[model samples]
Target chain A: MKQRTEERMDQDLAFLLRYENIAWYEDGVVKILDRRIYPIRVEHVICKTYAEVAEAIRQMVTQSEGPYIAAAMGMVLAVQEVKDRTKETILAQSDEAAYALSHARPTTSRQMQAVVNDARQVIRDALAEGCFGQALVEAVHAYALHYLNEKYQRYTRIGQRMEELLPQRATILTQCFPGTIVGTMLRACRQKGKEVILYCAETRPYFQGARLTASVACDMGADVTVISDNMPAYVLMNKDVDVFLSASDVITRDGHVINKIGTFQIALAARYSNVPYYVTGTPDPQHRDTSQIVIEERDPRLVTESMGQKITMEGVKGYYPAFDITPPEFVSGVVTEKGVLSPYELDRYFDE
Target chain B: MKQRTEERMDQDLAFLLRYENIAWYEDGVVKILDRRIYPIRVEHVICKTYAEVAEAIRQMVTQSEGPYIAAAMGMVLAVQEVKDRTKETILAQSDEAAYALSHARPTTSRQMQAVVNDARQVIRDALAEGCFGQALVEAVHAYALHYLNEKYQRYTRIGQRMEELLPQRATILTQCFPGTIVGTMLRACRQKGKEVILYCAETRPYFQGARLTASVACDMGADVTVISDNMPAYVLMNKDVDVFLSASDVITRDGHVINKIGTFQIALAARYSNVPYYVTGTPDPQHRDTSQIVIEERDPRLVTESMGQKITMEGVKGYYPAFDITPPEFVSGVVTEKGVLSPYELDRYFDE
Candidate 1:
């Protein structure tokens, strides 16, 4: 690769192409991408107070790493609110701020909780040093910058591994958007002068593929094509698909992958069609099996409507489970920051 | 049965419910239900001439039996248009009228072409017998009524056979709205004091399941739930699914079933789960295999948008194959007017 990972991160990262100003500090406002209406319209949720940041998380203005960034930004906004107050009040309010921000999306990602806890610890250290003036705000901002930077480096590792594994001019079928995980991978392929064609299934209810994946891939110089969720099997059955790669929300020790609702079905079809299907991301180390993982059943209205528009008959009931489990038997590999790990070698792959 | 097939056909055969007035004769106009904007909006395409009827067919304003009925009504309307003209002109225009109607949806169903051909023959005999006035119009009307009656009877036989096979209170997962084939079957099941719960996937681009099937099922006294196209595999994997019955657009001699794009995937999941998957309706006697059957590649805009709203990123292409082929191994039964035939018993089913 022409640009090394350290060189890329030091100057201008590839994330600037689309998400440059999506999450940033402006005056006293911590702005985040309002992902609810993404791809259709580019808008941001401006958080003046920590509560607004929490509400944005609860309302799902952004998801995955977006939540972690938003939560860290919330802490930055938290210290700004109590600058005029006493030192005791500032210390008391900061803990409350952490609780409010982290609890907004409690089950989001372990990284999000770690970022929140780290930010709180940074605040505690600043207060302990008896420098509650400018040192405190600078410390929180430094931690936020480091948190996102570390996350990007992890993404770079995953992308490099994906670039090494994915074939040139590959037809990759993917489900929901996995933040910058797929975008970085496509960019990495672009750096090697490889043309990566992505077939993105428009994940229903949330439409993560349509609103996020396709948009991100297109902006990153990849040829992105959107297909309805039902069209994946047909494409796999007809086209000369090189691989089926998706980002997993959770990967158990037994290699059971769980992500968006349609991932399992795509994996099933890929298994039957003899297509190589891989889940590329970091797996939750604590999760041992599918039964322990809690699958969220979303409100039925999300499925019956789109972009806040009702598309079904008045009396029709909708069944909407946000995610489904794809047992290890259907999965071929798990491409992670460490390396490309097979389903059977998941335990050993993480152990090292 | 509480309602005899002939008795119901003479009056209201329950095609109403949601698809009411889709095809009907009103004064001098042949009004066809504009199925494109169905359930959400009830509108009709008034066919005043043969060309308008052909255009309606091209626009997909009606499908399956709706097109057959619409075509017959268009013929009756065509006869009315030229009844006051000279006999020579009347006979010439009638032949052209039949050509226009039949070619409107050639690959739709063989029954449609046969009905159009039958009406044309009736017109030819009427003109040869030296009848040129009210007798000719009555003859055309008789052919239309007879065409609808026979089609309904075929539907009745298929519905009855389906009723015999489907378990009571069965949880059925269905793909695209299989026109009145599924609605009629559910009605027959309902009539026999059986309760069937349906999981209807809202077929993308064209919401046949959400806008047509689930609406009709609910109005016909069956419990129906609408799901996004991606939910079918999850439903089959988790739910106590009794059967997977989809309407076939074209069922080949070797038992290859081609229906809506999502049907093949559902069949795959069903086969893997050991759920009985059936393709209801008459098999096309002409097509010998899947390769012979032409799959329509629909406009990509239909996939990028939903119910007239754009849902994809700009510059993102969408691949929308309107129909997909499911091999014989995925199918367990093909319910027809003859009987509930096995995939391998297709030739024998037609032979009898």
Candidate 2:
């Protein structure tokens, strides 16, 4: 019965919201939908080896939650590489692949690492029960698929919670791509006859908000408009923005939200403007606060140039810090699969 | 003696800061150094007629104070166009040219209009003094040149005031191109042997901060770094930004500042971080406050594409408001030719 409900929800998602479009594994190949040039070009980067998948993540072919999903599938590729070998060899190789995948991007890596580690433990348990060879490969593949399914279901529940929390009619200001949760929330809103207007900040250096978030919102049939990264404060001041909603790459147990580089500024503006800022994601039990968070500084070339074309002068220097930490004070609430909880009340998310 | 001092000051400016390089009138043609593709290519868009000059300003071939200077020279072209006609026809044609140049871009148009109108009055005065034809053309040209000299001298004084206001060694955060004032300030800082670090927000859509501001600062031999527009708030939080300084397109008598779209957000962040935010410009005696300011919505194509390459997907809508208003409460002070005055004390700027 639960499977039937999830299948029905799957049909309601936009093209990009579908798990297969974000990433998929088929016949010894892990295919990741290249989000860097997505919507403009629907192409995928094919990876036959785990290292290739890790490189794709480093190159940002897939971003946000796509990395986490792709990393899990990468572990499957690791097992498939040595499927004919001993169970001990497969286990050792898969652990190495998991380490490589976890370190792909610093800010979002911890969760991906945890997912891969859990899969490794599952393999260890299955091996003790006599699972080996092709059966071992099948076991890892099934584990990865199951993990992907659980992620989708969790996001769907969070989206439903978001739908309930959002007003019947709302104008939301969001920064960067928030993964499939936005599309799922839009779908949920449609079912309940709620109206949502989205203003996406065109995340600079990489136009994720423009190409990914806005495209997904458009696919979900929401009234969406893309604004440059700097326009959010102006929009909040002039436009009727009901809420400032974004996805948190990491939500610390003590309630800080680490997200894309521009999120902190928007949160400041929202707080000053009397608008509540809510971040969507499950809390990280490992991190007690923001001290453990590493703000990744990507290649400066990404800022100085766009699509291999120089936007500024040749000699000029550019700084590109990929993520920023938003303190708990600025974040009004965290929308998790459990429900909408005050930033201070995030401990409830981990109670189970 | 005054002319010699002005000439010596002229030598200290960056290549882009020189008046002739900004916009020059020679042999009946007004040539404007195109800032849109400047630093990358030192090219000028030649304008043979007043209409062509006005069109260039509208097209943003020249921006900020470039249009004001170009508009003044544009009036010279207007007078040159009617050099063979009667004095009455010359005066009438110049008036029409003044009106067209004044309305080139909304926020900056009022000043451009005022400069052209002042040139028109000079033409009328010259005609009354029995000047005609070629003599009339020379009179308008002389007036425009004198106006240009006065502007440079005023900005130099303002730059000195800024140098006095800034700390001995400081890191300043600025947004967009603030015309020649930034170059003048850098020169003054060098003279005083004060160390300075500049973080420029690469104002999106046009990239004026990256292409124009950073280039000028580099020429002036200052330590400069270009950051994406979204990164300013993050920098303010993490980096030691001693001051937030920017150029205001319009400063009303009530002390509100209207500048490039991203300025307001930076001001908010600076204020939240407990840093003073200062804007440089003379106050408009004609207007009372932000109510009279016109924030321009530029072409969406400029936002969706960078250097003719599509940054976002097709069929996506982009919002591009060229400027935003910063309330008096957020502005630390207004740096004018007279001195650095509190936003509330802007009335002193018009005491003359």
Candidate 3:
């Protein structure tokens, strides 16, 4: 059976929070991180330990939070299966698992932080509830899985609420990866059987659109066309792209989003064309409120150097600015793990 | 016989000054205006009457005064070849011819203006020398040819002197069609047997470098590479191009040279690389003293439109700025009809 949009959103969120192995395993099925080729294939590369799970993520075998965290949860379950009885041994193993898995890729640190925090919380909560040994382990596993499902339910609620904010069959232009947050939202729309067409930007330096997001939309069965960054302003000027949606690597507490450099120009064009633009990111205290957030400065040589199977020499100096900060005023809305927050509702999103 | 740099400069300058047919009769060969290959290649058009000459010029069938003016000289001679008593008819025909020719192309009005002015002057000079009828026609034709040849000689001298200023075997990056101007300057150096490799920019909106200048340089046996304008700054920043040469469409009496937009950027890069930049143009009264000169704005849609042959239904707008003004300070020297003028010699190039 084809997974409806609501089903995908539920699956993504549930997958993000769950850790137990199930007898009913599916291959060529949908996963969160690598959205491009999901549902069509549900093949699972099972690993027996946390180290093994870290290796999968380091190799980018499992990509987005939905799959990545799901894989992380599997690692936690693997640790529990072979873990020592003593608290010190378990704590040490948990730290090792979290550090190894977190550094596997440049990811939303919040995902790993949240999962590790939850694992620790489950242990404490189980002990406080007078659960111990095998019972404690069973309770923790069940709680982790339940939390994952709860996040999925929240996504559905958010997606349903956002539907009222969006028109039927809206045309959207997306930059970078929108994560499972917007994916869930879109999935929710799909469950309702809404039609949408996505114009994807072939984001440069790293072709996130070409490599990641385009396929995610494609997997979700949204109409998608990938174009170069230089072509966006022209497209925005001529085509009737109604909405602009993008994922943010960093969002400050005050609601400022730091995204790709050309994103600002795209936002400028969208503003000129009267298109609504949105940015989404997961929020956590460790992820720094607005002031402590730092933008990444990459090597300028990356711009001049061509990235192909083999390196080629280009006889010109190139200037590459990686990130641009979009003013909150220009943003239409902000989506978070908690909910889809309005650009003006920073206080609400970060209130906790 | 191999022409010396001095003789070539003189011939080129003389070619710039006179109408083509007379110049052709005196030199025994027609100088072709290759720029007329635009829109379509129509008649293997030649000018025999001043009216026909101006119209050909107005139509840009004859382009670039350095050569077309010589051809126009030939046309004046052709008119003279007609019945001696019909000289009055030729004179009348020439004015009407010039007026019609002036409307052919937009911008760069100097070439046609030179033709009309020289034809009328030759007529007046002939009538003044007590020459009448056939003698008057012959006198006018001979005088026009001599005038053209002398102008070419003077320009050749300027080119020769400019050659000494540049190193032999240098790599040069140049903007726009300097063929009749600094292009002739480089040809003068070739007459001296200097080796130079030219990196020519593909000036857009009109692919002047790709279509006109590159072919001219190649035809004249200059070592040349045509690259798009987008590629130059990087190439210059990394590649060891020794010099930059650009020709301006307008030079105000104050000495600012206005040429293609990216010229300024090219100049900036050349300066950063410690390479000398040169601007060349004919210093004419109609180019006007600074107070009266007007810089024409080319279409901006050229920037907004797609350059490739195939059209896509979706894409963003592009920006195309036709010309940019280069401050005299950034230019090492300006080559004109008379001599190579330094920025400080603005008063000398024009005495307005």
Question: Number of the top candidate by TM-score?
Answer: 2
Docking quality tier of candidate 3? incorrect
Q: Compute DockQ for each candidate against the true complex.
A: 0.77, 0.70, 0.04
- Candidate closer to the true structure by TM-score (higher is better), 2 or 3: 2
Off by over 4 Å in 1: A1-22, A83-99, A103-111, A131-134, B1-6, B10-20, B84-95, B109-111
Report the Cα RMSD per candidate: 3.4, 2.0, 12.9
DockQ of 2: 0.70
User: Which structure is stronger by DockQ: 1 or 3?
Assistant: 1
Interface RMSD of each: 1.0, 1.4, 10.8
Candidate ordering by DockQ (highest first):
1, 2, 3
Candidates in order have lDDT scores of 0.78, 0.86, 0.54
True contacts kept of 2: 0.64
Candidate 2 segments whose C-alpha is farther than 4 A from its true place: A1-9, B1-9
CA deviation > 4 Å runs, candidate 3: A1-3, A6-352, B1-31, B36-43, B48-52, B66-71, B74-90, B101-106, B110-115, B128-140, B180-194, B219-222, B285-291, B296-323, B336-340, B349-352
Q: Worst 10-residue stretch by lDDT in candidate 3 chain A? A: A21-30
Q: Please rank every candidate by TM-score, starting with the best.
A: 2, 1, 3
- lDDT for predicted candidate 1 compared with the true structure: 0.78
Model 3: DockQ vs. true structure = 0.04
Residue lDDT tens for model 1, A245-306 = 88877788888887878888888889878898988866667777766777777779887787
Candidate 3 lDDT over A42-63, as tens digits, reads 3455655566666666544454
